[model samples]
Target chain A: MSRVLSIVTGANRGFGSSICQEFVKFSPNKEQHLDFILFARSADSLKNTKESIKTLSKVANVIEEYGVEMSDIPQVEKTFKDCLDKIEWNKYSKICLVNNHGTLYNLDKIDTFTDFQHIQKNNDINITSFVTISSLFLRKVKALPNFKDLEVTMVNITSLAAIKPFESWGLYCSSKAFREMFSNVIAEENKSSPNFKVLNYSPGPLDTDMQKEVRETCSSEETRQFYLELKKNNNLVAPGDSARALAKLVFTYEFTTGQHIDYYDIKEK
Target chain B: MSRVLSIVTGANRGFGSSICQEFVKFSPNKEQHLDFILFARSADSLKNTKESIKTLSKVANVIEEYGVEMSDIPQVEKTFKDCLDKIEWNKYSKICLVNNHGTLYNLDKIDTFTDFQHIQKNNDINITSFVTISSLFLRKVKALPNFKDLEVTMVNITSLAAIKPFESWGLYCSSKAFREMFSNVIAEENKSSPNFKVLNYSPGPLDTDMQKEVRETCSSEETRQFYLELKKNNNLVAPGDSARALAKLVFTYEFTTGQHIDYYDIKEK
Candidate 1:
């Protein structure tokens, strides 16, 4: 029987966890074994995700859970290297890497950003590590013994802020833009590989802890009010709903490689 | 008599030096005193720029030249803070900050990038320092007692790669995108300030050392050839020409506060 491997970062909770569960719940092939390699700040945090995935699909198994500090470049490199090295490459016909771990450095206007340490840390976590991990993943996977035959997909969890600037989301917006463009270059570089796919998926204004933080702490009163209105109107999309759409995109492979697919755009379809 | 203070980074050579020279060459009010603060890796390297500025405009003076390592976050913050503190804030009725320092980290496919240190350095130089300096500039200037009466302009030296993704230019494209988005947020954040102006200027392809590096070292054969053709045909823009257009925009201030005005866009006009 064929097998699939899904490596997900930030899989401990929120949208990341939802993505893992949805992928298994909606799997088209019950006969195929689905293995997961989950990464978060703590391996222990991935317990709920592992339990939920097992409950949803008997074919699914949580193969590995890594405790990783994404901001520490050296550690990130070491952890990913060990994980990829241990993977039984020949056992899986499909592989997907979801680069989803991120943070809101602060909800403040650009002029007011004074803490240089905070800024550097934000870049280290969001841009440096993301690039480092993505580079490692592509290099390792492409060198596999049966590389051409395996279907590969890379997803970047992006945002509307990636393309549009927001008043108080200076750091967040720039980092997202960086990731989206990086994903674009990946798509362009791998265009010749028929079995390779790249996607930038914007999960929308999710009703997650991040959203709550945005509503409470945004420096711009107007922006904060906007999020508050979204919350009050019950308009923020559920993590599961957005995750299901993302899962559908991953399985169907309907998107043009490097295309950015937002939850609303897919929902309208 | 009104005075203008211009702070320009990467002013030691290339397009940066051209901007300093052009600003003096095209000053509308020749009688008005012009003061410049130039930054580059070595203050000694700024001799040519300082000399040329003096030759172009009798009233123009190189007030200060700072040697800065753009990749060092703490140093970047300290240098800017010290520079801003020494400025006679009340003396200048017009201030313009030209953020022009940048680097091409590499010319290879993203998958082949293995040096995590190189990636971190690129982000430090391109994104982190840019934000740090810009924030410092804005905060310092805005706090002036006469800020409302002063004309404040912020120019981000952006590029075509900022909006378009190129194969084998992953790091460069992503950093530019980050800067452009950050500039957009600056525009949005300060829209209510009538005297404030921000511009993201894409100077087009320039005949410079950077372009030479591109032609010789680009990993993509097609990209290298395209740049080579531009050089052979003398199609590459002269730094002086593009700098003149940028100066025109600064002086005219006809553009919307947050507009991205490319050289080609203005050349047609």
Candidate 2:
């Protein structure tokens, strides 16, 4: 039996942590062992997620955690490459990378947030790093022995902002849009490679830290009220539930790449 | 008897310079005086553009050139604000800003360009500064006496990349997309006030230094060949011709805001 490797970002909290939980508790079968490499900002925070994964896991698994600062691209690339080097690539029949780390740094109107420093910082952390990591992962997997035999999946967590223009969320919206378009381009680039899959997944409005930021910081009354209502009406999807739905969609054998899918899309199917 | 103030970026050469020429020589009537504030990297280069504008302009026009580093937001904002402050707001019947400055810095594959520093720099100069300049222009115009009577227009020069995905041009494509979406949001925000109009204009493939860069740097053979063919077949539109078409669309009385329009879209009208 072949092993499975799952790498995830923002694994210290919210949807990211829940994603780690979902994957760990997913299957109890003894045939395929699992390995988890989680990326987060704090070593202590990752320890908590590592502990939770161990408790829920039934099959024997290896859980590794790293403190990842998205702004430091050099360090990020090195850490990811090192992780790949340490692991035995031939053992895993399935390899997946979930790019879940993102930031809505400021709720100011795009023009009001005029400082290039702030804009550059946000772009680096949210969009550019995501691109770098995705590139590195793809390069690593393609170098593996019998790479075509193993399934390789790349998941980019997208947002409604990717398609919809929110009044005050310009930076967030456009960056997510970039990720979606980049994913589309990547999918097109890899059309000839059947084993490789790219998915831009919009895990709709989860009760995450990002939502809290939106609720608190949004400049427009309409946007503020919309998020407030989601919370007031208990309409926001829980992180765990979203994670389960996302994992279900990801693990589905018939799931196609090059698609921007939402939680409801998977749920309806 | 009202004058016209035209502020343009990347005006040292190429499409930007042509846009300046089109506006200066637009009307044969001597009643409307023109004031041109052109931005570029070097003072000497801007002087050359100014000299050309002086030679081409038939009307009695005042041309001022400013060397601006687009990467520096504070300097860009200050220079723009100073220029606006020096002008008599009521003097010009039309106040227009043309955001034509853009850089396609390092057109390497997104993943292969692993350095976040380079990516961040490109994003800052291309997109963030454009937003800053637009915001400042809008603010300055709104503060003008009898602002509603003066025709205020903000034009963002976009590319085919704004709507289409091209390989190895991730940074350029996404930045243009951001500008397009930003233009949309700005138009929506100003809908209640009709005097303020924002346009995202795709000028098409002009024979500019940018196309030259594309021809030289495109990593994908298909993209490289396409641009090469454009140059070889003399299919690329001249900057002056593109500028005339763009100015025609811009100056058209029936043009609507909130539309992502191109040369063909205007020409067919």
Best by DockQ: 1
The local distance difference test score of each candidate is: 0.93, 0.78
Docking class of 1: high
Model 2 over residues A39-125: C-alpha lDDT tens digits?
A: 898767887778787787656454677887887777777888888778888888888899999898677764465565666667778
TM-score between predicted and true chain B, model 1: 0.98
For residues B106-126, could you state the per-residue lDDT of candidate 2 as single tens digits? 776655666666666677788
Task: Give residue B40's error in model 1 in angstroms.
Answer: 0.6
**Number of clashing pairs, model 1?**
0
Worst 10 residues of 1 chain A by lDDT: A260-269
- Native-to-model Cα distance after best TM-score fit, residue B137 in candidate 2, in Å: 2.7
Candidate 2 residue runs with Cα over 4 Å from true position = A27-31, A60-62, A114-116, B27-30, B58-63
TM-score of each: 0.98, 0.92
